[model samples]
Target: MHIRRRRAVGRHDASDYGLRGAEDGAGADHPDLADRRHQADHPPGVAQVAPWLKAYFTPAEHHSPEMKEALRLSDELVAKLIANDHVVIATPIYNYHLPAVLRAWIDHIVRKGLTLGFDGKGLLHGKTSTVLMASGGIYTDGSPIRDRDIATQYLRLILKVMGINDVTIIAAGGAKGVDLSRVTREAFLERLDSEIELAGA
Candidate 1:
């Protein structure tokens, strides 16, 4: 099984965060936008068979319990997601890891008895979750800063509990190469487009 990673690029606006692609034409190459366009063209998973897709948008009203409930209602979230075509998480990386807001959301969703529970067989399982993470710096497996990949490990463990063995990761940021240019971003977009197609297939 494979895990598909979906990134959240537009989660941050230019005026707020000092990301490179805040301007109008700047983020065209962003992995999130690229996946959006690709999904628009080719929807992933079995839409007809699955049913509804409840996309939980985060980074809004961090103090609200309504937002935190997304995780608490593990059964509800799983039912909504499993019945839907595919799962997509659009999240940007902050400080080399998942943003605090995202982390909070995760805390709510990963309930022990709800999202995941172990059988007498000592196996863990449940719903499928995917993540797409983007950061200003690159951590593509072996860079010095790559040690900051605790987010990936954490996500993987969460999914594992829910019985989701399929996992995919797409990393895009300054770590891949030294020069962060439009060309590089475009290249990343192209790769993202291809991955979307593969996921759809």
Candidate 2:
């Protein structure tokens, strides 16, 4: 449910989201490499599924489509996750909640009878997930207009729907007003370093 200030790419493009291909084709198939197969033999930590992270700081290769097309392509993230790796999402909160792109990605990944299906016991289960969010304001508890980080709550529900109940959040706020002339960007980078270390542990 955390919102990262940075945008995420769903193995489609590095940046820029625009849903252009709505009526183009619906059943066209992606490559076999694009398919997410559960490989139990692989060790944990050897695999992971953070679409944006894979392309972090890299040059944008292409632009994502708009609307439903963008959501459809975001399924690549789920494909990467099928290998049974812990997930860490970096995103931003917009309009007091997660960005539409993030929601779009959620729609792509949370599949029925795939990510979550009733077992013989009628229970559900899936992978683990986490989120890192950045915001412009300092309201950790949020305001009347804002739902006090409703993004995090919604993310939990997303994971819950997929039977992935293990989730964590790290929030960064008021980053825009920082005194870059004084402490500089190193300080912020250090915080990210520590966060990555802790998450890796």
Candidate topping lDDT: 2
Using TM-score as the measure, the top candidate is 2
Q: Write the per-residue lDDT of candidate 2 for residues 156-191, one digit (tens) a residue.
A: 777676666777666655544443343344464456
Which ten residues in a row are the worst by lDDT in model 1?
8-17
Report the C-alpha lDDT of model 1 over 57-84, residue by residue, as the tens digit: 3333442564444333434534444343
Clashes of 1: 17
Regions of candidate 2 where Cα sits further than 4 Å from its true position: 1-77, 118-126, 141-147, 179-183
TM-score quality measure for candidate 1: 0.52
Stretches of candidate 1 above 4 Å error?
Answer: 1-78, 118-129, 175-185
lDDT scores of the candidates, listed in order: 0.45, 0.46
